[model samples]
Target chain A: MNRLNGTLLRTSLRRRSFSTADNVDGNLQGSKVQIFDRHLKRKQRDRAAWLINRKDSLVNTVADNLLDRLEDVKKTFPTTLCLGGSLEAIRRSVRGRGAIQKLIMMDSSYDMVKLCKDAEKDLASDNIETSFMVGDEEYLPIQASSVDLVISCLGLHWTNDLPGAMIQSRLALKPDGLFLAAIFGGETLKELRIACTIAHMEREGGVSPRISPLAQVRDAGNLLTRAGFTLPGVDVDEYQVRYNSALELIEHLRAMGETNALVNRIKFLKKDTALATAAVYESMFAAEDGTIPATFQVIYMTGWREHESQQKAKRRGSATVSFQDIQKEFGAGETT
Target chain B: MVRANRVVEISKTLSEILVCPLSKQPLRVCEKSNSLISDAIGVSFPIVDGIPCLVPKDGKIIEAEVSRDGDSANTKRRYHQDGTGGS
Candidate 1:
C-alpha cells in the first residue's frame, strides 16, 4: 500500500476497472512515483526475483518463436518496441550480434521504467542500444512513424484502452513495420475468475472480481486490421502452472510487481462478510496438487505497415514498379 | 529468517501508529501471522521483511473459525450489544 507522510494531497489514486492512465491523482503522483522508485529495495528485489523464476518457465517455451521472427522484424524496422518489458528479460533471449538496432521499453508503471533503465547493466555490449519511456500503451510519447517493430509480452491485457493502444501501436510504426505481441487470453484465468465469482456470490452478497480479461489472438488480429496494420497474423498457446496455494499465487504476482491499479476498486466489504468469502475462495480454488492452476495464453501477432509503394501503384493505375526492384534498391543497407 | 526478524521489529513499532490508507482505521499487528489487520477492511496486510504490502490483492480476509450456525447467536449479540464486533 502506498502511504504519504508529508506530501501535498491534492488528489487521490483513482480506481478504474481498466487502466491507470487517467486515474493517477495529480497530488499523489509524487508519492506513487516514490513508492515505485523503492522497488529495488531488498524486500522488493527478492520478491521480483522469485516471481521472474515462475514467469520464466512459461517464457522459455516460446523463446524460439520470439527469436525465429527476428529476421522478419529486422527486414521491416530497425527500432523495436517492447511494451512493458519486464526487467528486459526478452533481450537476453534474442542471441545474435546487433540483431536489433534500438530497443524501446515502454511501461506506464514507474517501477518498471526504472527497472528497464537499471537493466542496462545486464545488457550485452553487442546488444542494440536501449532506451526507456514511461507511458500507457494507449498513449505512447514517441513520434508517429518512428518505430519499426512493436513487441509486447503478457502486458497488453492490463491496458484499459486496448483498442486505442493497438491503434496507437499501428500509428507509431512506419508503413511496412511489424507488430508482434503476447498476452494472457480469455481462457487464461477462467477457472480462477469462475471460482472467485462463485465463492463471492455464495459467501457474501457480492465481492469484487479483479481478474483481467484478455482477448484471443484472432480477435487481436481483427483489432490489428482495424488499426490499419496490413497482413496481420495471429496465433495462440497456453501455459499451465501449478502454485502451492492461493497465498503463493498472490506472492508470485506481487513479486512480479503485478497488482490491481484499476480505477473502479470497491471500497468496503459487505457488512461482516469478508472472512466467510475468503473461506469459500480457499475451499473451491485450492487444488489437490496443493497448487492453484494458472493458465496463460500467449498470443503472437505480426503485421506490416501498409507499404507506400503499394498505395502509389494503386493511384498510378500501372504495375510498373516491382517489389523485387524496390528490394534490390532498399535492401542494400536501408536506413530505418 | 533474518528478514522475518526485521519485519517483526518494524511491526512492533508500527502496530499502533499505522492507519489504513483507505478507511483511516487503526491497525493492529496480527499475532499469528504478524500481519497488520484493519478492523474496517476485514483483511490482514502481510508484513514481509520490513515492508507491509497493504495492497488488497496481498491481503487475506479474515475468516471466522466459527460456523454460521454457531456464529448467529453470539455474533448477533456481540454486534448489536457492543460497538466492537470482536474484530
Candidate 2:
C-alpha cells in the first residue's frame, strides 16, 4: 500500500510540474487557448469561403494597397512575420522583395495552414524562407526578442486574448523591431450587431448574436505601449461595401472565414427566434439602394520594442526612490 | 510569505493550464533547478516565490521537452486520488 501511494504521489508531482512548466514558456493553453483557437478557425473558414466564391476580384483589388504597405515594411525590417496570412496574398505582396530573411506564418487551423503551404509552394519565392506553425494569436510559439518585425492582417481583433497576444508580440520583437497589423474596427458588422440586438430585444428581450470584437484605433495604440512597444503609431480607415442583402453580407463574412467563435457564443438559438431575427435583419435593408453596408475597419500600426537595458535602468531609478519617500509623498504619518 | 524572486514549484494542473507568455507553448517546471522549460524555444525560466518569472530577461534556455510527454494519464488519476491536496 505504501509503495502504491508513493507511486501515486510521484505521478501527481510530475504532472503538476509539467503544467507549471508551460507557465515558463508563457503559452496559456488552457480554456483561453481553446477559445482563441476556435475563434480563428471559424473566422478563417468564413473568409476563405467568401474569397473563393467571389472570384478573387475583391481580394485582388485590395492587393495593390496591401502590397504598397509591404514594400514600406520590407525597407523597415530585415526579418518579418505575418500572422494568420493567406499564402497567396502574402506571396503576391512580397514577390521580388529581397530584404526579408525568414517569414514565420502562423494560423490556428490545420486546413488553412496546409492551404497556405500549398499555395506558397506554387509561388516559388526563393528569397524568403517560410516556416509554417499551427498557432493562434493568443499563444504564439516563438522566441522572445528574436523576431525583427511582426505583421498581422485582419486577425488580431478576433483573438480572445488580445492584450496577451499584443504583449507577446512586443516581447517577440527585438528593440526597434516593427509591429504592423490590420484589424476590423468598431464599424465592422455594425448593421449586423444593431439588427441582432434589436431583434433579440424585441423577441425575448436580450443581447443579439455575439459578433466578433474589433479594436478601436486608440485602444490598439494603447495596447502596443502597454505591451512594451515604443513609438506606437495607429491609423484607422473605414471602407464601406454595399451588399445586395443583409444575408449576403453575413455570407461574405462567413466565406472570408470570419465567424463568431467567442467562448461565450450562445449555446442555443431557438429556431423561432432565429427566424424572427433573420426577418428583422431583412427588414432593415434600405429600400432605395437594396443594399446593406458592411464596413471594414483597417488599422495600420507600427512600433518598436524598447531595449531591456533601458527598462532596467528605469526600474532601478524607481527603486532608489525608497518606500519611505513614497509614503512621505502620499502624506502619511511622519517618519519616526 | 511568498516573496517575489523566490522560486516555488507549482501544482501540476495549474502548469497544464498556464502557458509561456512568449511561445504560447507548454512549460515544464524543473523543480530541482527551480526553472521552467519551453520545449519549442529551449528556454528554462526560474521561479520566484510561488510565481514563475517566465520573462526571457530572467530565465535561461535548456533542452526541449525533457519532462512533458509520457506522463499525462498517471498524473490525471493521481489528481483524482489525492482528494483535497491535488490541484
TM-score of the first chain alone, every candidate: 0.69, 0.72
Cα-based lDDT for every prediction: 0.57, 0.60
Question: TM-score (chain B) for model 1?
Answer: 0.59
Worst window of 10 by summed lDDT in candidate 2 chain A: A28-37
Predicted structure 2, TM vs. truth: 0.62
**What's each prediction's TM-score?**
0.57, 0.62
Which parts of model 2 have CA positions greater than 4 angstroms off? Answer: A1-67, A73-76, A85-88, A124-126, A307-336, B1-87
Best by DockQ: 2
Error of 2 at A290 (Å): 1.6
Candidate 1 structure quality by residue, lDDT tens digits, A227-317: 6777777888787777776556556667655554334445454643444434554677667755567776677776677886533224465
C-alpha lDDT of candidate 2 relative to the true structure? 0.60
Per-residue lDDT of model 2, residues A36-124, tens digit only: 34544644653573354434444434443554565664345556667764434655567655377777666655455556656776776
Span of ten consecutive residues with least summed lDDT in model 1 chain A = A1-10
